[model samples]
Target: MAEHPAYPVGLRLTGRRVVVLGGGQVAQRRLPALVAAGADVVLVSPEATPSVEAMADAGEITWARRPYQDGDLADAWYALIATSDPDANARASAEAERHRVWCVRSDDADAATAWTPATGHSEGVTVAVLTTSARGRDPRHTAAIRDAVVEGLRDGTLVAPHHRTRTPGVALVGGGPGDPDLITVRGRRLLAEADVVIADRLGPRDLLAELPPHVEVIDAAKIPYGRYMAQEAINNALIEHAKQGKSVVRLKGGDPFVFGRGMEEVQALAEAGIPCTVVPGISSSISVPGAAGIPVTHRGVAHEFTVVSGHVAPDDERSLVDWPSLARLTGTLVILMGVDKIGRIAETLIAHGRSPDTPVALVQEGTTAAQRRVDATLATVAETVRAEDVKPPAVIVVGAVVTVGPATAG
Candidate 1:
């Protein structure tokens, strides 16, 4: 039992000497935070785990590559005594005490001068919880509390409206290939704080249901060669909401920059003097193929993978893709927004030098419950799409890599 309650304080260890006596699991877990805090850490250990060795190789910390010895903590501002040898730990702790340096012991917490708390970070706030009682300490309970507080803060469930300084701006967030769980933590946090969400139809539609009722959700769904909201109108909406002092989030499917025309929105926001943040999402170009058990690049089979926009036909004057050059390359080709132009694309690729027998796969509604894969060859892909009734928003993979994984039948 601790003699008194542990006083909580944030350590500014930047440029200060920190000594870690162990290079095992405990050190592996705690070293990263110490490095992130800009601490000049010296690790004293005969050997270390692979991860700790990686940090030393990267020059993040100095590894003594020997067991702890006397005077090891002579210049340390802080010490973590976690060596396998109990005697060594006791000697290090005694030395740290004699030198007036605060020390934490992994084995004996009560004997240590300092205790590491269960810590969590949300936004710019750090929550550290420590439970010290005459009975005993509960680390798991402390960790659970920390996780709850951080999660609440991140999701806006524990909102302190009076204390929050709401900054009005526009954020272009990638919703990540139709899976709500796949959305980045930063993106989800920003979404929870949004006052207005201009959502695309292809984005993770499930997340919209979780938004607070006060948030205005606008359907800016853009369909290929179909009825859809104009890009100019969407930009105007973002500018209007931001100028009105509202936090606006443009939630897009896959990556906002992967043929998503996200730059246009950023440029528009800049012209209107609105602060914009772009959070990248997992693009379906790679992720969709992966979700359907297809690797864009396989060893010996494919060395490179190219992502192209298939929204325009190869014969169209607006098309900018060099079909002849693409066919000459022996690599994987991932086409997005090309469901309608699959026939023209396949025909053009074949005419230029690509083999007609090359494997082709179309992954529809990838990473979602509605996901399905339709397999064909470059020669039969156009007809396969027609027979399968494959719709828009499917990723078309053309290469030998299409057959690299287990057979994915629709």
Candidate 2:
């Protein structure tokens, strides 16, 4: 294999004709980026996954509403083929080259020219970490390790504002989905010492009951589907307080960077030369599912899994999710933003040959006393959730491993 030219900047696709070949959640996620990048986004799929249809109706993208065919790459600058079909991705990968367009295989990009970079963004700065297996799956793990790295970097000697730190501060640590015990020991240490605390409204009100009586607790929680504080502003408050040399903790609901924008906040601190550190929280992506008695991995049941956010739709219609690979995979699938896209996600899974009757569990407010697990299969999970009105801050676990609850004494 040859080295492709270094990416121009962050993995943002501004002003590029990126063709997304799927209409599922992952495609929904990548599609928004293509549009945000000023790409003349054209989605090639027979059906509009709900997210895609919404984006299309909102005029965020152009829709072809068809499967990949010959000349689908006609005049395309870059092609991202993300179908549930490995055969489709492979075929698309081959066709993209013949048309002289840059192509990315959603599952095979690492071996090819297109790759998604690790992204961290803030008001003042943005950092993207891209790796090609030369360093292994650092990009995949970056999402996991990035928070800790930025936190230390912000507070370590690397940042600026050299002075006698004197004000009360807090570390906005993500408590991960719901297991207070899952918190990084360091996060627990800081929370134990907090003079004042700010936490997501979605989290347990009692999670902070351990704080001293004199400690002030503020609910910075954002109401779902309603008005809320801009997350950046919340981050700014944490940094400013720390600048006063005060111990501050900006507690997030789950893995901060996963979908909560901890990366953006850390980047802001780095640029401002403020002191900060990230404490890894047990991500809801895994914990929530686990709390539901679903082992994210089992010896014969599953060997690997993918965690993706349901926060936003992708600008590129093509997603990198290899349905064939995933279907053939022997690992459980845990979705963080699972509730929001349950219908579309299940649709795609079933469409791609995954058994519609495959067992799945959606755990709401996982790991806490308020947690509830609704069990069903891929075919019925979405409808069941709607009927039950199960909400977000939930984890959706899909696989045969979910056939019987992992903790249910099979």
Candidate 3:
């Protein structure tokens, strides 16, 4: 006779006692979600992975240093059997059954009465997938489906009207390094609920295009450029729309605080008494070079890396960059918005103390499908830039680290 299909339901494990009978890979993967769900997890294992040990040290979960013993599942509401030793796992599962606690067995799913479903959450909605039938399908297929559904929800392809709430406020979101997929989950969720989005040229423009038709999209680059006119207009726009009960999203590329003038906007909004929330994005200073296979700070090659904006010419009296001091550093140098001033910047570095033979890499439109890299020595980089016609929105890396290893090459 065949067994009946198990009934699927959500478990509210908040502050509930949960026992994990192993501290290996399966336990490592399951611990995070259990902790996140507010479960008081007790892990029983003689030895554990470094990560599990770290969690125990951090007080997120209680760890039993010794092996699992009889009555270990006493008073436990839920238990997981995931030990490498089959005998130990079987004993733990049997004990859990005696205590009337639901048990999940990683070793033999068919033998276990409870089945863990593939789960994912987006914008306050949790999605769980499970195969109740005895025909053993792959879990990877279920995970892939879960991922696709989550992506659709995040990118606005899948609509859940109840999940969206348009509160009057401003969100300063970092769009990450040019990739639409790189935007943070919270950022994407807020964007989906936004009434208006004021976006920069370098932000995740692809995401802006995916916004609902009713949502207003403003081009930040097209806003009038002046000492204060453009910025004031933006501030006023944010305040005015928000005051009218519209949720505004101010989206920029990379981290808003990293040379993105995010603080100024925050101050401006505060002075006007407009509510604002900041969602940090991935900074391109590191991601751009990394996209081109460059490590800003390698263990043996470079101990530190400095990121600077090269929009100003090296000889410009108004420029604040300390070129001579930078040239003296032995670590890596990453320059943003420096394509046009590469010639002068290179000249200044060489004139100071940096070697003319220093390896240099120019990554253009990094982290995107249009990404390209130009590699050359400091002395010849200017010529290479001109010959290759390297464009703006590029990252310039200088130091021996460029050519030293598998990192960004020169």
Candidate 4:
């Protein structure tokens, strides 16, 4: 008999009983989706993988720790017959069939009442692909098609112009630490939907090239100490574009609130009576140090880590940081935008009681192709920066934690 085309319909499994006959790789892969759908999942397996066991331990699923017994699918709305033993799987599938419950069999798809589709999601849409030919099943082809559609939707390449919804507002999106892939999913989606993008000198610059031609890209040269009142100009631009009924994105490097003046932009938008959304990005404060093989806080090394802006010298009246207090603590110090003033900052820390021999690691262009790490001590960091010709957009880590992981050649 020829295989009939499988009817595709989403099952609303919320609060429904889902019986999984095996807790091996197949069950481990499928359980999360079941749990996410709010299904009451029960597993009947003599043994399970560590990951599946962890789910049972975390109260996400009920584990029977036994073989599939008769009537296991009596109350189940749906069942997965995936036990290693073909006999056990067939028995469970027959029980499901008798109870009128839909079942999927990992070992025998044709013997099951239901088939799992290759699924991917993007921006509120779920893409599920299935190939139903009995002798020509190609899961890889289905998955590839799913991935292509999802990727296109995510990057705005396959946008439906007729059904596009335009949201007019300013969004402060943190693009993450210099890497496009490091950006948050929401941030990337907002950028795809943006009509006007005002981008900073830092953040994922490569993403700009992927935008549709209709998008107006403006270079926000808000480089540190470059121009006075550049932030005011950016704020005004955001207000102006949003008032014109355009979706605007202020793409900044690292987290917008982490010394990126994100709150100031929010306040400015509020004063202008315009709506704004702030999407947090991965901060370089800790990520950069970790990327350079330095943990901000290590076991028995440093207990606390403090992130501070080194844009201003310690002696500068505009500075609000307490060098003496920071020096007294034996925690890690992560400084951003302080490469130019590192010499003065190091001296201040030493004068305030921090050891001159404290290890320091400067990660430049972190999380990007141009990334490089430079090592030094508080006493020689100034000279190291000078000798190495390290530029801006670097994260400076200070503490014994810098020496925790395998040392990277500076």
Model 4 lDDT on a 0 to 1 scale: 0.91
List model 3 lDDT by residue over 1-410, tens digit each. 47666699989999999999888999999999999999999999999999999999999999998888999999998999998999888888888778899999999887676788889898678898887654775789889988888887876678777654656899999999999989998899889988999998999888987888999998887777665588878877888888998989999999999999899999988998888999999999999888898889988889999999999998998889999999999999999989999999999999999999999999999999899888998899999998988888899999977886564433
Record all residue pairs in model 3 with backbone atoms less than 3 Å apart, i.e. clashing.
Answer: 293-408, 294-408
RMSD values for the candidates in order, in angstroms, are: 2.4, 18.5, 2.7, 2.7
lDDT of 4 by residue, 83-182 (tens): 8998988888888889999999999988888989999988677899988654688888999999999887776677745365666899999999987889
Candidate 2, residues 1-410, lDDT tens digits: the string is: 66544554454456667787888877877777677678888888888678889998988888888788877888888877788878777788888878887776667655445666655542234555556344355555766555554544333312333265444544658786666667765676567666667788654355687776876676665423335456666666667667766677778877777777788778787777776667777777777766777778877778788776544423226555555556555567777665877787778777767888888888887778778888889889878988888997677788877765544311
The worst-scoring run of ten residues by lDDT in candidate 2 lies at: 153-162
Query: What TM-score does structure 1 among the candidates reach?
Result: 0.94
Q: Of the candidates numbered 1 and 4, which has the greater lDDT value?
A: 1
Off by over 4 Å in 3: 1-5, 133-138, 163-165, 225-228, 405-410
lDDT of 1: 0.91
Residue 208 displacement in candidate 1 (angstroms): 1.0
Give all TM-scores, in the order shown: 0.94, 0.53, 0.89, 0.91
Clash counts for the predictions, in order: 0, 44, 2, 0
Q: Which segments of model 2 are wrong by more than 4 Å?
A: 1-170, 222-229, 313-330, 404-410
**What's the true lDDT of residue 210 in model 1?**
91
- Global lDDT of each candidate: 0.91, 0.70, 0.89, 0.91
Which model scores highest in lDDT? 1
